[model samples]
Target: MELNRTTCYIASLRSSSVSRGYRRIIKGFTAYADVCFREFGNHVKFWTTINEANVFTIGGYNDGTSPPGRCSNCSSGNSSTETYIVGHNLLLAHASVSRLYQQKYKDKQGGSVGFSLYAFEFIPQTSSSKDDEIAIQRAKDFFYSWILGPLTFGDYPDEMKRAVGSRLPIFSKEESEQVKGSSDFIGIMHYFPALVENIKLKPSLSRNTDFYSDMGVSLTYLGNFSGFGYDVFPWAMESVLEYIKQTYGNPPVYILENGTPMKPDLELQQKDTRRIEYLQAYIGAVLKAVRNGSDTRGYFV
Candidate 1:
């Protein structure tokens, strides 16, 4: 992928049990990055593993609609384990590639390496207080901290131990150190938000409603959602920027994605005005954060 003066490209190369597959994938990716960078100079500067490692489970395994058709709860004939293994392998592979790129090009042109990943925002359901809070935290842990923990802090979240018990794999201190803080950029793609709630501690199934919605909340929590008022609030985006800044040490962030969807068929209403207002409000919030010293570079709608 050339043009726009890019020197390299990075997709998702997760780290998990599928080391062999991950290795092969990264081999191809690295070859492409090298070809593009050597041939283009300052055009492209990095490469990625795959894109959005979490989808391997969150959107694929737990949701029956996607390819591979892995069931939720992950008990779809062991498909859950398969998805987790693949996701883990991809992350490790990605880290490996970043390490290799850093080593091979250290004396060449001082170029950098990194990957782009989608990040999800989770909020606890209004009810079920303590349990809901834990649920939201768990969702965040599985959704964001899964990658961030291993990449930034060098370990999996503690909750994983409780969820999968001894089934969760362990990483050696050496391996942890190897991947810790390996990437030059942590690209974040975000849209909408998720409301989480605790359930009866059963393995998830293919068609089960999201824990949040199943707990009696509406399904708008799922994708491109913007209703139930607050359309003019920019605080949501602000909170996200602040969270990333604090958790990841303000590493250079790019708002890889941000946008709202308004159905074209709907008759115009006051909320329509609110939607435009929301955009201005949120953008202002982002600008304020940047002015106050956030590292956000750009946004994509």
Candidate 2:
């Protein structure tokens, strides 16, 4: 698919309603996928239904940090529900495209359709405290399980359903069946890890409270969040892979994005010593993870 075009269409769909505009998104993507399959399926064995699906939803709808930005306090969009609504629609769209490929192209092309998301390693802010550890789990549920749980188990995580309450969309019987096992694999973009601190929900928080508020945890980004010349914790890569393997039934995995950015410098660009070391450590971690029986199939910088 032409990523730039599809992305613009998708990034704008959150403001749409399921009755009309949302279905258009589903049809639009299916139409695009059909074309891509016909044109590129023979050579492209692996197809990602969406790039960084989780981040796409969060950055656009909840945080208003990216294209078609929308948030609780933004000029439009309800951060509390739009994110989930858009995420739900994305899953449906993916499932539709996956079904289309499986029925029409998979046999001849021998290709696969997969979903991708952005992931970051999370550790307890207070290493010795169980609450912080539990907070980490909650954070994963809100982030990873929110998308993966449906793709794997045909439903959102129990924690998300409970936390988001009626704001979360429900999957119909057919939709649930379509969503479960639709992906042949999982793709992830992993960069840095974060220290997660447990937080209490404020009494004044409303139904329109944002996802971060609903998540009930705060992240202290390591390396000050820019990820340039910071500490390299390769073990976190292994940790992330292990968690996905264990939590999500060890599906075939690919590291679609992994690398640190560096400031502009001619010598630095030529040598790239820091990036070389960063990738070496992370790729080594992936190697160790594969050695330890992770179903990880590929890694990319």
lDDT of 2 at 10: 37
Q: What is the lDDT of residue 301 in candidate 1?
A: 58
**Candidate 2 structure lDDT:** 0.84
Across 248-268, the per-residue lDDT of candidate 1 in tens digits comes to 788777665566666664554
**Predictions in order: lDDT:** 0.59, 0.84
All candidates: TM-score: 0.73, 0.91
| Predicted candidate 2 versus true structure: per-residue lDDT over 1-301, tens digit per residue | 4221122133544355432226677888799789988977776778888888888888888888886777877887788888888888889999999999999999997877889998889999998988999999999999899999999999998888888899889999999999999989898888789999998866785345778878888999787455446677899889999999999999999888887766788998778788788888998999999998899998987
Model 2 earns a TM-score of 0.91
Off by over 4 Å in 2: 1-21, 205-208, 225-230
